[model samples]
Target: MFSLIVGLVVAVVLIVLNIVLSKLSFPKEGRILAILVILVGYIYWGFEPFAHHEMHPHVEHASYSFDGKQDIEALEHAGKDATEIKAFWATIAKIAEHKGDAVAGKALVTANCTGCHSIKSEGFPEIMSDADAAASYGVTPPDLSIAGKVYDKNYLIAFISNPVKAMHIEHKYPVGGEKVFPMPASDFMQPQEIADMVAYLSDAAQKVPAPTVKKGASEFEISKAVNKEVFETACVRCHAMNYAGIHAKTTAEVMSKYIGATPPDLSQYIRSRGEEYLHNFINDPQRKLSGTGMPRVGLTEKAESQVVEYMTQIGDSKKDEREALAPKVLIYLTILAVFALLWKQKIWRDLH
Candidate 1:
């Protein structure tokens, strides 16, 4: 988190430096070189692949892979009415299906995509083949060949224009709630261009079946560990400790007065907000609730969700008996660990 803040500061400084350098009376040749260097550095900084590129998996047979060759054949083989595309997409499968033109789609992708994307030869992480390109973009662009097999024309057209609206649950980096990074809004692209690209991508995705799901056991374990850390730092300060609400006797008494004005009890808040709002508020408050007293508590989406889940489970109970017990357990465990380590090392001194 600190590093991310520092990086933002560094980026600002570099932008200022670039602006300053432009006004200086440098030689024409030197100025040109400086501009070129700055441009290159900026691109590298944004992409980061130039410095530490993750290598793309290589395609085994080069000659076999043509622009739309395999994709077109796959779509053709899948057949029109009988294919899974019809089942999945229903009426929306017609646009790609009607044209059944992989060649045109590939041509469209090549012309419009090169600036942001790369084919086999160009760019740091060479998009080795169709699979390579799809993976890099973070979702499978439809296989034009098989695209007609699945979605109807309307779905394809709508999807090409605005990906965020189309694949909210899938394509995006999930940050909780409806909030996400403003991404490649395809509004500027000509209608024909979007149609062509959609024709290509939708057709392409069909050729490839869904990628196999990786085991998330380790990921789940890490999430649990991070959740505990987040809870300790944030929630423990308010809910568990006496610091949550107004200065009254018990937490229940404090919370009764603290309902609207103060940060409400986490136990109650979780039930009121549900998982989505709670998750969003933890990651970024502004996106979820209006006039949220909760400051942006620095926790990742995954961690926030996990902590919320943990809290919600406890919310079923009304008692505050476990509140003070958690701290006692922590202190006892800390003492035990320290004494055990000291005894193991034979470092225990006389209690003068």
Candidate 2:
């Protein structure tokens, strides 16, 4: 913001300088050259602000963050966020210590989770279709086919234990961070049981690889479609891009209440917020906006890149055309300025 303000100040000063130079026998062409010289600094400052902005969440860094490498215990059984965070991480730490038995997990998951979720590649299908699921739960449950491969290992464990707290959407969900979520918290299950379920999902994901772009396919189709699957897998539950003809499975009114407001139509957000902010915001929403209902969607880094690429393609692909035109505009101005300077020199010599 400061840089943009400074750049505008410099631009105003140059316009004033051009007016002064015009009266002193400098031709318009010569004034163009003078203005261009003055603009070099403005060019840098004007564009620098958009290149990147370092943003951090309002939360104090040390308050709730944990490295997970240390032995931590709950300092108290209280309602404080700090204490809750410590307990959460400590539980995650304990879960990490156990090795999962996928065979045992398959049975447990079938009994506990398959009613809500489906592992299609493993031949398990949910009792209800997506529409019914949305009607029943207010959001269609995501398939678990790629969850193991695409989500962060730590995040998956945390999500299973406390969806509201782990996703940082407690403001929208129940206070205990346990009941009433689309998927009930498995806090009753042992940490090892949770790990086993994660392991079974991971093993299943590995056994059946995800769809891939075919070699020698049309680049036009490939470029547009490559990241789309990733976007759908990660973002299409409650958000929609109407320009792209992608509708949310959950209706607007349902999501409006679910998240405290209808989520914005994300068609032009790339142009509005730019890619850098989206990257950081998606990585951790609370960092950018405290109490934001958007989850810290636990996509792996690669999947996050793919999702952003898809958003950029649909939201602001014209940015390339605008960027491509800028240099040509600058070049044309330089050529015109050169001609103006030459004419000014001739007139000055003739006056002398």
Q: Which candidate number has the best TM-score?
A: 2
lDDT of 1: 0.47
Regions of model 1 farther than 4 Å from truth? 1-101, 118-190, 212-352
lDDT of each: 0.47, 0.74
Cα error of candidate 2 at position 52, Å? 10
Overall local distance difference test of candidate 2: 0.74
Clash count, candidate 1: 21
Cα RMSD, model 2: 6.4
Q: For residues 81-174, write the lDDT of model 2, one tens digit per residue.
A: 4655776777887896789888988888888888888778889887796677888887888878777776777778888887776776766776
Clash count per candidate: 21, 2
TM-score of each: 0.23, 0.73
